[model samples]
Target: MQITVIGAGAWGTALAIAASRQPHAHRVVLHARDAAQAQAMQQMRRNERYLPGIDLPAALTITSGPLDALLPSARAEDLFIIATPMAGLRSTLQALQGVPASVAWLCKGFEAGTGLMPHEVQAQVAPQLHAGALNGPSFAQEVARTQPTALVAASPHASVREALVQAFHGSALRVYANDDIVGVEVGGAVKNVLAIATGLCDGLDLGLNARAALITRGLAEMTRLGVALGAKAETFMGLSGLGDLVLTATGDLSRNRQVGLLLAKGLSLEQAVTSLGHVAEGVYSARTVHQRASQLGVDMPITEAVVALLDGRLKAFDAVQVLMGRGPRGEAV
Candidate 1:
């Protein structure tokens, strides 16, 4: 199988290394938009700007050029994984129009301004393409080191799921197929917003009991919005939902969590974001998530609180106060 990963960020480089190291010797190409970065990775055999300590597998091919030139030779059997951030997904999918290949995206967030999920964006720009999301609790650095990780290969199309499994499932990686793309994508997008809230909870020196309460309620909020958006409720209990929420909210390497921690330390949003040196999806997508939930009449208090905190409308402590001050309601999700 030919696995072409577009975008040479940490996750893309990590997945490319993993695919190249497979015993099946699949052809894996990691494409960087910047020709200079591609040349550096080709010559140095490492993505120093992203996955620094890991060495790129010799079999992995690094390329960069216009999408028009790079994608013309793509075959029907090939898989194209878009590893760009949510902001770049639409443009990338637009470029992939007419390509007879299965596509999957690794980004996990709602699109800003449009408030659309990746699949929704694809439907608008590349509806003919067979696409899905490859999402789970795995981090880019851990995956790059070949750590054991299980991910959901979610698409309405069986062929997309099968191709993702064939290309990625082996050794330290486990790929599970799911036909509920809506459920999978909702879980992916909402978790980032909830993670920011969880980080704030932890940053304020809240007890483990508080953390547990926040995560549980956050899961309920995620399920409510997802179900309102045409996703199955049970899907939130799966890897892409509860699993991803737990990992991103508590994991030390989570950039969204880091943003919350930095904010709690009294840094301005600008300072915290500038210090991270990486795009934290929650910071960018919190407003969109809140907006979509409002439009759908879904109660997403945690996400709403996150949006307020990110927008400077509330302080970290004030956000917690607001959440705690809410009137009692039924426990239904």
Candidate 2:
């Protein structure tokens, strides 16, 4: 099997490495946008910048080239994983327009202006392609290190889900197939925004009781927005929804959570982002998530708080105040 992974960021490189380790001697190609980055990874046998300390598998082919060079060679049975951030998803899908491969993306956020999920962006830019998404609570560094990780292969198409399972399911990585693309995408995207709120809650030295309450309530917000967009309510209980929210909200390796932590420590938004050196999806998608929720008549108070905090309209303390001050309501999904 031939599997090509585009985007050489930490998540991209980690997935490429995981696929290369699959039993079938799968031909895995990891693409870097910059020729110099590709050369460096090739020569060093490591993605030093994004995935440090983990050696790239010798069987994995690292390439730097135009989309024409890569897409034209992809056959119908091959799989393409677009590992770029949400902002790059449109262009990446456009580049793969006529490719015969079953496609999936690793990004987890709405497009900034369109407020569309990854699958939505794919539908708009390359509706002709068979595409899905790979998402869950797993972190890239752990996956790259060959640790046990489980992820969802979400697509309305059965073949796409099977292709993903065949390519990535292994001892170190467990891939579960699901037909709920909308639910999976919504769960993955909204969790990032909620993670920021959780981080802020933790950074404020709030009690564990507060943290637990935030995660539970955050899941309600995610499920509401997801269902409003036509997703299955049950999907929120699965890996992409509740599982991902728990991990991203509490895990130290989470970049979105880090953004909130930095803010709580008194750093300005610019300083917090610049310090991370990586894209925190929450910082970019908070506003869009809030907008989409409002459009759907879904009340996402936590998302609104995150948007306010990110926009500098409210300080960390003030954001908490806003959330705590909301009128008491029945706990409902």
Top model number, lDDT? 2
In model 1, the worst 10-residue window by lDDT is 67-76
Q: Which stretches of candidate 1 lie over 4 Å from their true place?
A: none
lDDT of 1 by residue, 1-333 (tens): 689999999999988888888889579989999999999999999999999979999899999998887688888889999999999999999999889999999998888889999999999999999999999988999999989999999999999999999999998999999998888988888888888888888999988998999999999999998889899999999999999999999998999999888888899999999998999998998899899999989888899888889889999999999999999998888
TM-scores, all models, native as reference: 0.99, 0.99
Query: Whole-model lDDT for model 2 versus the true structure?
Result: 0.93
How far residue 45's Cα lies from its native spot in candidate 1, in Å, is 0.4
